[model samples]
Every structure is written in structure tokens, then in C-alpha cells.
Target: MSKALEPAGPSDGVNRWGLVDLFAGCGGASAGFLATGAFDHLWAADNDRWAAATYEKNLGHEVATVDLLEVAESSADVWAAGIRARHRGPICLVGGPPCQGFSSHVKVRGDSRGRNTLYGAFVTLAIALEPEVVVIENVPDLFATRNWELFADARSRLSDAGYRVRARILNFAEFGVPQERFRAVVIASRADHPEVRFPAPTHAQGAFSSVQEWIGELSPVASGEVAEDDAMHQASRHSKATLEIIRQVPADGGNRPIGVGPECLDRTRTSHGGYTDVYGRLAWQTTAPTITARCRTPSCGRFIHPEQHRGLTAREAALLQTFPSNWHFVGPFDDRFKQIGNAVPPLAARRIAEAVLSGGSHSEAGVVEIGDEPIGSSFSVLIPGIRRRGGRLAEGN
Candidate 1:
């Protein structure tokens, strides 16, 4: 909470970023942030033991599995010491508050069960740790909704801390993700530099690019079949009754025939608008719909394979999430699904990471002389639009 934490233009010693991930699941954000070489994960926390274990297993970081609400920031010193011991300074706070309340996938009813209040715990920690930079990722609806006053509270708190916080809804497709993912991202810094902007798009049209183009090479792995590099992968099992329903639905086709029923023919489904992706087969020609937790069930969403008949496996979903094929996961089957479904696409994360780190690259050109730190301190002048490219780096990496 020093004045130096107040916003300032690019300078050395301010940009060398470290990271801490709240709701860290299997280290997806950690993987992305580390891959960018912009920030190192100082520490991470999550309530799920399996997920936290997975994070610790893969990243070898001291991730804690305590409920964030109960954990006191006063006790986070050991973790902070790990950060200070290695990284220079200017830690970056990176996390995605659990967004189930604002998610379109689930109904956000019940005031008492309003899990949105958990977001407040994040800001509380933010104020306590007072990281130089903060990155929050959530569903697009997050910005549009007023759930727990968390957004309002976070906005006020960050600004009160003298941070220039900006929020924008960014599309993952524009950022190089094969899938069309619209998310709300807020990057806050205690002081000023250039206005923090989402990175520019790198995956462009007719460049021989598309969702299909990205995962086109992976041979379709049928349900129950293990991927070559996959160890914990499991293809969703379809019940006999459920399997019968999907047969009637066309690929990339809705169940209106069965959904709305009456004159059209089928009468099984009621068109509840909730279970549309059920038994659905993806169109090889189009991008896959947003990956959801229920995606493991064909009856949930368009969790079906493009050409295959079964739901996509956790590993496949991870690939679609732009995680490297070789990228590993630890945990049981269900835990694996939750991890992949909840992870920040490494591709999308890196776009912001590169942009955050791009200042050093720019300073090398003498265009901007950012301080020692990367993101919070420096602003990218050369390719400030880098965050927009999303998953495009998958091709090169």
C-alpha cells in the first residue's frame, strides 16, 4: 500500500511481475502466465483439494486447498516469501472468481445460495496483498450482471487503492482460441501507464484459420478410447435411453423436432432452452460452443464430438481450451473434467501475458522505456494489440 503502488507511466523495477491465482484449478492460468514469461506464479489457492493437488503436482508450487473465505491474508507470508526469494518485485494478481452465478449455463436464482459473494473475498485479499497488477477473467455476463455487489465493490476498492482499473469483454476467437469464448477481463494497476487494453487479434480470417482448422489434425478419439498422450482421459458414457435420443438429432442440429414437438413430429423434449446441447454432434465446419462443466454429459450441452457420436473427453476439451497436447493434468476423472472446464485457456491467457510482458520488447526498440517490471509498469507500444490474438500462438508453439 505504498505510494509507488499508485499508478505511474513505464519505468524499471515496476514491471517485473509475479503472480498469485485465486480459484486456481490445475494451474491453467499458471501455465499460461508462465508460458508468457511475463510473470511467475508466486502462490495460488483454491478450495478443491483435488484441483489444488493437481496444481501442486504439475507446477510444483505451494498451492493451498483451504476455502478462500476462511483463509486469512495475514497467514500468506510463507507464500509471499517464496515469491520475494526468487522474483524481483511488482507481483501480478491473477485469478478468475468462481463465475457460476453470472454464468449463463446455470440459473442464478436464490439470494441465500448466491455464491457470487465469494468474489468479495478476492478483492479483500487484493487489498491486503496489494499486488502491483491484478487480472480477473470471467464470463461476459459478469460485467453485465449485479450479483453480489462484488463487481461494484472491486471497482471501488481498486480505484480507492489508486489503481486504474479497466474492464472489457473480449472474445477468445479473436485472441486465437478455436472456440468462440466471450469473457469479461479486468486489468487493474495502482497507477497509470497507457490505458490497459485487450490485446489485438492475431488469428485473422481466410488466413486458413478457423476452429476446425485448429484441431483438424487430431484423429477423432472415440469414447472409451485413450488419447496417445492421455493418461487420465475418460470419454463420457451415454445411457441407452439417452443414446437413442441423440440419434434423432442431426449434427449441429437442434432438437426442435423433439423440443417444440406437436406439428413437426417428435415430442420427447420440451425445448427448455437449457438442455439444447444434448445428444448434439458438432459440425466439423463450425467452432465448438463454449465448454461447460456439464459438457461431460451429452444431454447437457453440445458436448458431442464433431464427427464422433459421444461427448468430448476431458483431454479433448483441454485441447479445445488451447492447452498443449502434451500438457498434463492430475486428479480423478470428474476432477479432471472440472479442471479443464474451468481453466483459463492457456492460449487466451498468454495473449494478455504477452501484452503485459511486451513492454520489455518495446523498450528494446527504444519506443518505451518501461521500468524493471513487465506488465504493471511498462506499456507496450510496438504490438500493444497482442492480447487480441488469443490462441494463435498454438500454431507456432
Candidate 2:
């Protein structure tokens, strides 16, 4: 591997800027930044042990497996001092605070109340390190709440700390990932620095490759079949009855029968006919639905293979997320799935990182609104921040 591609320890000095990923689930954003050939991996932190281990194994850097709030209140300085000792160059703080509480999938809507506050801790860390730039990625619902309060507050806080912040929602497929994943992105820089702009899409909407293009090369395997040579390629074992039900569902974009068998949702399927994507098969010719933390399970939203009668293996899902084939994840099946699903597609991340490094923007003035045209017919929303250079949202033809 080239020096830029090789995993680096905290001390390796082969790159220009430095990056520390908070909520760094298995180093997705970090890997993307490294791939840009612009930033060196400096430090990382995550609360999950398995995620930290997976990140360390793939990136060759130790992840401080500490809770962000505790670190913020007690030992943030120590973490910042550690990074300073390793690299004195300007650093960029990048992360996606957990968004399950804000996600529409979660019932009751307000269960994990403390989760939203995690962004404040991220801001606290950014303030401690005084990084030159900060990037945050999250679910798009984060920006839609009453007046975009979460976004407004974070931008307000960063601006108070002397950074001009910009937020946008970006679709991963627009940047080369084969999955039609949409995410909210926020970028901030020192007020005196040149204005930061969101990266323009390299792939036009509906012009990108399909799921088969990303994971087609993987050898097909049956449910419960483990590729002895590749640990992540193992699929979940299904019961005999469940296997039969899955076989009955038509292949390639087929959803389970609405009112028949165990495939139909218990109450919601009959009551509201909602969640048609559950137990649906992925179409080989199209980009995949967003991979969620439960992607390893067949019942989780359109994760079934188009041809095979099984849910996606961890390896397949990772490839769809644009993770390198050689990138190894360390964890149990479910944990590995979560790490893969939560990752920022490296292709998308590399583009954004390059934009930040080059200070290249379509325009230097106004807020740049992205994710206006959702890829693969997925929903997209405009975030309220920054004025577009033209004072209008960039629309798609």
C-alpha cells in the first residue's frame, strides 16, 4: 500500500492537516479523510469497545473508548494535550453524534433524550483543541425540527468560538457510494479562514452505479453460510419456516406479501399498511435503501439480497457503503453491521475532505444548500444556514 493508504499511528507524519474523529464508529470518516491525501490520522474516540477495536485494526491508531460527556467534563484537556504532543499542525475535528433519538424510525420520538445533547460535547471537544475546521454528519431529520434548533445552536456555538459554520444535507450516492444514503453535513472553519463550501456532487442524480456494481463481485452465499476465508461474508441463519417464507417472496425488488405469513408486519401492516420496505428484496439494478444498524437481519428494511434468499452479509453491506474490500471490521455480526451501517461512505468523505483542504467552493459567498434532490427517490430537505451565493437553493433539472 502507498504511504497515504497505509494505516498510521499517532506519530506518522506523512500528510498535511491532522484529524480527530469523535463518535468515530470504526473510522469511516477518518478513512475517508485519509483517502483524500490531505489529512493525517491524529487521534480518535468512541464509546463502543468493539467499534474502537474495529477502528484500531483498520486504521492502526488507538481509539480512546471513553464517553464523550465524561471526557468533555473531566479529561478533554488530556485528550487534546495528547494530540498536541503528537502533531502541532492545524487539526480538523470531525464526527457524527448519535442520532437515534432524532431518527423517525424510533417510536415515541423522545426516548433517548440525552442523545441530542451529545453534539454539545462535540463542540466542547472542538473548543478544547481549537481545530482549524470541524465537520459533523448526522441524520437529515436533525435539521428539520422546529426552526432547525439543533443546527442553529451548534452553528451559533461554533460561531461564538470564532468559527464560521455551514450545514447541508448530502446524499452519498451523489459522491460515488452505491447506496442511496442521505445525511446531514455541517462544516465550520476559523472565522478568518477562507469560507468553506460543501462539495458539489461528482455523480449526477440517477446517473450512478447500482448495488450490484458495488458488491456484485462477491461470491454468492446462502443463509447461514459462512465464507471460511472471509469472516464478514457470513449470513444470518434462518429458521426453516422463515426460509420458506422468504423463498415465496418474488426476487428483485419484491416485498413480502402484505397480509400473508410471518413476513407481514404484525399490526402496522394491517392497520396502516406502512413500512413496505421491510422484508423487501433489493433490486440488483438499483442503489440500495439506506443500510441501518439492523441491516444484518432480514426484517430490517429491504436488506434482502436480490437473487439470494438471504439478508446482506456484513461484507456485502460494507462494500455498498464504499468501504475498501480489504478493510477488516472487528466485532460480532450485529456490531459489525452497526459499524458498517453507521459509517460515512469513504468516497463521499474523501470528496468533502478534499473540498475543505482546497477551500474549493462553487461560490465563496452565501450558504450552499445540498441534498435538495434526493437520490434514488429518497426524501431530502434543505437546511437553514448560510446564504447561497445566488440567494436560492440549487435546483435539479
Q: Pick the candidate with the highest TM-score.
A: 2
TM-score, predicted candidate 2 vs. hidden true structure: 0.83
Stretches of candidate 1 off by over 4 Å are 1-15, 72-86, 99-116, 192-195, 204-209, 227-229, 251-276, 359-397
Per-residue C-alpha lDDT of model 1 across residues 1-397, encoded as one tens digit per residue: 0111122343354556788888888777777777654465677888787778877876778787776654433344554455567776667788898644334312443334333345655776776676777888876545443432446566777789778876655556665666656566888866754334456566553331244655556666665677666574557667765656565666653442354313323322434334444566666666677776667777666777666667777767777787766556776777788888888887777777666655332311011111222222112121224334432212221
lDDT of 2 by residue, 1-397 (tens): 1222343334345546888899998888888888765677787889889989988998889998777876776787887888888986778889998543324423443623332367767877888888888998887666664325445666777888899777665667667677767677888888766766777667664576688787777888998998878888989998787677688778988988855455348578777767777778898888888887888777768888988989899989888887888888887778898889888877777878877877764632212353322222222333221123122235431
Give the range of the ten consecutive residues with the poorest summed lDDT in model 1: 363-372
Model 2 accuracy (lDDT, Cα): 0.74
Clashes of each: 23, 4
- Candidate 1's displacement at residue 305, Å, is 0.9
Q: How many backbone clashes does candidate 2 have?
A: 4
TM-score of each: 0.73, 0.83
Q: Pairs clashing in candidate 2?
A: 366-387, 367-386, 367-387, 367-388
